[model samples]
Target: MHYFSQSFNYDHSWARVVIGMWHKYPNPHCSHVVTVDVVDRTVDPRTGIIRTERILGCKQRAPIWIVKLFGGSEDAFVREISFVDPSTQTTTISSVNLSLSQFATCNEMIRYSPAPGGRTAFHQTAEIETRMNMWRSAADKLENWLALRFEQNAQLGKVGFTDVLRQLWEDAKDKPAHVSA
Candidate 1:
């Protein structure tokens, strides 16, 4: 919710803060946190020539947060910047996954999950639009948050972010990590 850091010197080397959330551990690469387009994110089905996408790291329109839902899991992981409430001067240091998967059941989970509200029974009702509105509300807020970060980063130069954090290992490490809040 609130994050800040003092180690940055202003001479940022990386251009963008592109992140890749994975379902595996013991990261083979030396960097658990890859540079934004510091590398590529393509997996060729034939040659396996991984290529990094430009503007992959920190970008003006990209989502600072991403939500991933693996097929076999019921947990949600949120990847987002921990910024000091609305000041926008400095920034939250690391990419954190605020594990919000402790709700008792799937239905209950949906009730509390950070998904955009949408019609649950799409076929049999007119509330579908309303449900979608809820879902859209979350996305809209997330987009706004990301845009603010992009603007902040643009002012300082490129540095995926001001602070890099290690918050994913805490609660939802084993479950599907959802970064969008």
Candidate 2:
């Protein structure tokens, strides 16, 4: 199992950040994300918290050997769940790949919190677990490769999100002051 975490600040309010998150895909930095669909969405009447479940289709640029080893496939599906609390100004999201979980599982969690100066603090945590056959040397190599790929993907994901955040900031400036989240 491998674990990693990172933190950063975005020059936008928590409300704007949370709104931007909903449209983060299809960015230039994350071209591998082919499609996104919202499976479910609901808002709690009592708590005013919003919950959403989404699925993302990803095309991985994996080595041919890796693709052949995994049934000549480069497509992966990811399931994501998010919770947004309006009153607390906090949002949490978790995502995991739904395919090929028997050999490995990678899970990522992100949190958006209100920060000083109208900034939004973003924190992300990623975990990868590999289940390999003890007698197979290829399994060990695959695990290492997966870990490295995950690290790279995380960085790209951050860049993609930042691009979306900047767009959101610009859009907010265009909106009327009477508008409310």
Candidate 3:
């Protein structure tokens, strides 16, 4: 299985600020931003694990309530990005794990669910919460570090959609004439 792990330490209340901001604007860049909206954002205050299906203030686009809470793993994914706000500090962690065989179909990752063999939601909720916490802590540290570097650089900004399209177009531009598209 392939996995991506990262942790970051935010200065002062940076973690809270970032987490709050992310919860508001999950997709900072409009580039890959589809109609992806936060139809809901409820969380368990005690554990910081999400509780409701959708956060009340989340502004999801019409339809598609079947949002994905997590994605990417070999054993039926549930990658959650969690931010823990302690009294003195906050931590943000994000991780991605996946199988070797699911490489090409990775984008269709939502299909990878823990509800295998007809498992009920009650059984899976606790498991998902546990997994969310694991990844959340890791993401907190990784994001904190990233935020610090970005702060030091002070030049990082959201990457736009055109950048992705341009890269793809450029790569295709060099295609052989025999392999015309």
lDDT of 1 by residue, 1-181 (tens): 2122222232221111112222212233222223332222445565533333222221122322343411222233333222221222222222322232221111100000111231011010000111132366554554444344423533342222223313332343454434443
* TM agreement with the true structure for every prediction: 0.20, 0.89, 0.27
Question: Clashes per prediction?
Answer: 31, 0, 23
> After superposing candidate 2, which stretches have Cα over 4 Å from the reference?
132-136, 174-181
Which ten contiguous residues of candidate 2 have the minimum total lDDT?
172-181
Quantify all predictions' global Cα lDDT against the true fold.
0.26, 0.82, 0.28
Instruction: Put the candidates in TM-score order, highest first.
Output: 2, 3, 1
Angstrom error of the Cα, residue 90, model 1: value is 32
Query: Over all chains combined, what TM-score does candidate 2 have?
Result: 0.89
Look at candidate 2 and tell me the lDDT of residue 42.
98
Write the number of the candidate with greater TM-score, choosing between 2 and 3. Answer: 2
lDDT of 3 by residue, 61-126 (tens): 221211222232212221334434444233333323222112211111110111333221110011
Q: Cα RMSD to native, each candidate?
A: 20.0, 2.6, 20.4
Q: Report the lDDT of model 2 for residue 110.
A: 93
Off by over 4 Å in 1: 1-134, 158-181
Instruction: Provide the global lDDT of candidate 3 against the true structure.
Output: 0.28
